[model samples]
Target: MKADFLLIGQGLAGTILSYRLFRAGYTVHLIDDAHPSASSRVAAGLYNPVTGRKMIKTWMADILFAEIEPFYQEMEGFLNQKLLHPQGIFRPFISFEEQNEWLAKSADDQFEGFIKEVFTGPQFPGVNDGMGGLLLKKAGYVDIPVLLQAYRTWAKSQGLMTEAVFSRNQLKRGKDGDWEYQDLTAGGLIFTNGIRAKDQGFFDWLPFAPVKGEILTLRQDFYSSKIINRGVFRIDLGNGLGKVGATYDNRNIDLEPTAAARQEILDKLRQLIPEKVLEILHHQVGVRPATPDRRPILGKHPSEENVYLFGGLGAKGVSLAPYFSRKMVDFLHSGEEPQKEVNINRFFKYI
Candidate 1:
């Protein structure tokens, strides 16, 4: 058997990259055991242009946001599912100082496109926006699990996916610089295996700071079309269903959803709104593949010519994966180099 690429892991990174490669007329065989708690499987899939405590525009927001909606919409059409939610984000002001700062930023030319409204008075009712908030455009959440499952079903039907664990022992380099794994021989291999890569031998030299996060799904009377983001993001999932998340813990390197995290989110939610939680429908935990500098890991392995790595998307996986996947696919399909920030070659000296 032969393929243009043999991809490891069917997480969001692998799924998107495989789809992109397939669309570009390349054969891609994916191997994944389908872990029950993979990060992509549990992600809320929020894509916001503005982020962080300082509340500034995300890096390359213009480029990343431009590719996001169209890319997810294309997948939605292909999968025949409504996975992309186009609701804008509403971030409440924490202090009068912050409100004043945003009022000034709203008039800035840089934020003109993404800024929907700068509320000097109030934005939403039945909420704790006494000082008002900034309504941002071109931001929303993707139903990641739905999209991943749809893609998995489609890939299985096409016989392009194998459900199994992938290890270095199964790989052998051919004389022509291709890779051979079991019955198939492929040109190259790419690893997008999330936190599992931390223990993988080939990538141990690369710095991976795995951060655990927890989120909750609640059934409440608070039904709003817009996503409210303050300390924690509150996304309305329709039909009195809402989602609030996520606590980032870099120190606690475990997947258990702690009671502390739950309390933290609850406290933050109360601070945002005075709504009563009807029921705690679900609680989930997943570890994000983060890095020291919080940039993505892309490009081929430094020593191995045919092996590649793509991850370190952290909390922004939903917003970053699609755009970077296209860039990585182009790099592999041709000799195009990824941007200096995300390219894996930046850490060559440390390795």
Candidate 2:
């Protein structure tokens, strides 16, 4: 088989990048093992403009937010599925000082687009927002699993995807400067694999700080249109079901869900809302391919010709992927240089 590009992994990074490349009129083939612990399958898929305990604007919020919704909506049209949910996010203030800070920010022109409302008192019932909170626009969660499954089915129908473990040993460089894997040959090879890239030998020198996270799905009666995010995030999945999560553990990097993590999330959920958890529906765990700088890595490989990477999205993949994947596809299709902060050239010194 021949293709313009051969991609590794089919998680969020791979899925979105391949989609963009295909839309750009490129022939692309993917090799994905369908790993159960892939982070995109287990992520809560929340995209918030303002995050963290400080409640400050996320990195490049303007550019990323602008592309997120429209890109997903375009994908929704292609797949004939409802994937993007722009339900908005409500972050309750942790302290009186925080409340005062947002009250002043609400008037700032810089925050005019993102800030939907600044409540001085409790706005929603069952939520623990006595000092009020900041309601944000253009913030919501994507149904990642649904999108991935839909894309996988589409890729298979088009004969663009292979389901098998990718072994670097089987990959060879042909005399024509093309990559040869099994019977497949491609002009370029891109690695969109997640934490697996850390041990992939080629780009292992790059610093990768893998963090393990766990989330839980619970059966509850709490109904809210907006996502409640404070100590933890509570996303109402509807039909008397809501999802709350996630516990971040950098030290313990494994796929197994721990009882302690579940309790931790439950405790944080209690702090955010007074909802009762009638039952625990599911528990999931996945390690994020985070970098020390907390920025995604993309662009061509340092030494190898026609080799590239588009990983290290970390916890913000839902927001970062749509924008950056377009950037990656452009870099691959043309000779465009991605932003220096996210470009793989930033790590050339280490290589």
Candidate 3:
């Protein structure tokens, strides 16, 4: 019943963090309900180096790529599963202006290292695609569900997992300045509870802009066997399967996917190709734990000495989690501070 750390939630953050802690020789007990969500479970797990409308490489793509290149490979040897794949995304130009901008940026030294200089001019096999799009050279996808499930199975076999919802009421702030759960106690606990942390008592002070994302999984036989990279992700998906995602809805009154929303994805997908026959295989939804400034939440709770948290990874969990997790783990064990952007205190007026 006692361990070194009590981890809440088993999403990508928890999964990676738990694995890290375990490797570091710490006993970690993970607790979660394992419901479906688009953040990790439903995410396409695409790692886009440059993002946004301009299609620029993401911040620190080079450093993150170096740190991450072998990180997943090290884990594959341990887990005996292929968790990360080195693939590129073909972002089809959405507009004539976009095409112009892509060409202009391709020569820009700012994007030189992240994206390729030349791409096969817009052409598709029988399927008309985009006008033109930049190739995300270093981008890839992490099979998050496989990673989650593999870690879950591993953690359970090690008796470090529990299938249950973590409630704050189960916590007791003791006079010893350590968190308490039942008769066991740890150095402290971290609230990596994903979107559910918005309701967490004292942690409520953190600003979180929850955005719902939806993805549709399709079974296609004719799609290119290779990872068909395209704008918004039209991958070959391999293994007689493909996943098309995603639409962001911050103003959704309901949490369910709608016909219009499904059509919206279809409409976007059709812009390039002659609308392929896409059947509604399955749909999933999850609230992304976003922030006003689009950074991750990491560090200790302000007033709670030993209590800590690691959440708000947003849509970039696949690309950002491993690097940031190492940073947070370093901070937790060595008192190091998080990077300026990911430092959770930035969003909090006072932490």
Candidate 4:
């Protein structure tokens, strides 16, 4: 078979990149065995404008937020499913000092686009927000697994998705500068295989600090339509169901859900709300592809031609993937480069 591009992994990176390439009139084939522990499959998929305990604006939030909604809205049309949940996020102040800090930010013109309101009164029932909280707009979550499945169905119907394990042994460079992978030949190849990219021969030199995360789904009687985030977050899933958690553990980088992690989430959840946990519906574990710089790595390989990588999104994959995917597509199509921060050349000296 012949195609314009060959992509590895069907995770968020691959799914978004393939969609962009397909829309750009390029025929791309994606290969994935669909690992059950892939981060995209278990991600909470929340995209927030403000992040971290400091509550600073996320990197490139202005530019990234502009592209996120429209991108997912288009994906909703293509997938024929409601995947984008546009409900805003609520972050409660942790202390009186934090509350005063937020009150100061309420008037700051820099936060005008994202801050919906700063409430000093009670925000929700069965809640513990005596310190008040900040309502942030243009922030929400995506149903990643649903979107991934939809992409799979669509890609399979288009004959652009292949379910197979990708091995470097199956890859060869043709004399004409095309990549020959098994029975398929392509003008270029991209690896979007998340942490597995560290194992690839070409990208092994890239700095990857993989971290394990644990999350939980619970059945509760709370009736909030917005996301509540403190140290941990609780996203209202409707129907007496809510999703809570995500504990980061860089030391124990494994895919097993431990009771310790569960207790950690519960501890954090207790600090935010007064609601009692009715039951634990589900527990999930996935490894995030984190980098030391905490920015995504995008661009072609240093030594090889027409070979590229798009990953290291960490916990912010939902926020970063869509925007970077377009950059990757533009680079592939016209050699347009992404910003210096996310461009892979930032770490070229290490490699």
- Pick the lDDT winner: 2
In the range 1-35, model 3's lDDT, one tens digit per residue, is 77778888899888888788888888788888886
Give lDDT tens digits, candidate 1, residues 1-351.
899999889989999999999999999999999885588888999999989988789999999999999999999999999999988899888789989999999899989789999887776876788888899999999999998899999999998988898877878998898999998889988888876775667788888888888999998888788999988889998888888999999898787889999999999998887799889999999888888889999998877788898888888998999899999999998979999999998888777
Question: TM-score for all predictions?
Answer: 0.97, 0.98, 0.91, 0.97
Query: 6-118 in candidate 2: lDDT tens per residue?
Result: 99999999999999999999999999998876889989999999888767889999989999999999999999999999987998877898888888998987787999998
Q: State the C-alpha lDDT per candidate.
A: 0.89, 0.91, 0.74, 0.90
Sliding window of 10 residues with minimal summed lDDT for model 1: 194-203
Could you tell me how far off, in angstroms, the CA of residue 148 lies in candidate 4 after the best superposition? Answer: 0.4
Sorted by lDDT (best first), the order is 2, 4, 1, 3
Output the lDDT of residue 7, model 4. 92
User: Considering TM-score, which of the candidate structures 3 and 4 is the better prediction for this target?
Assistant: 4
lDDT of 3 at 149: 86
Each model's number of backbone clashes? 0, 0, 7, 0
Give the winner by TM-score: 1 or 2.
2
Clashes of 1: 0
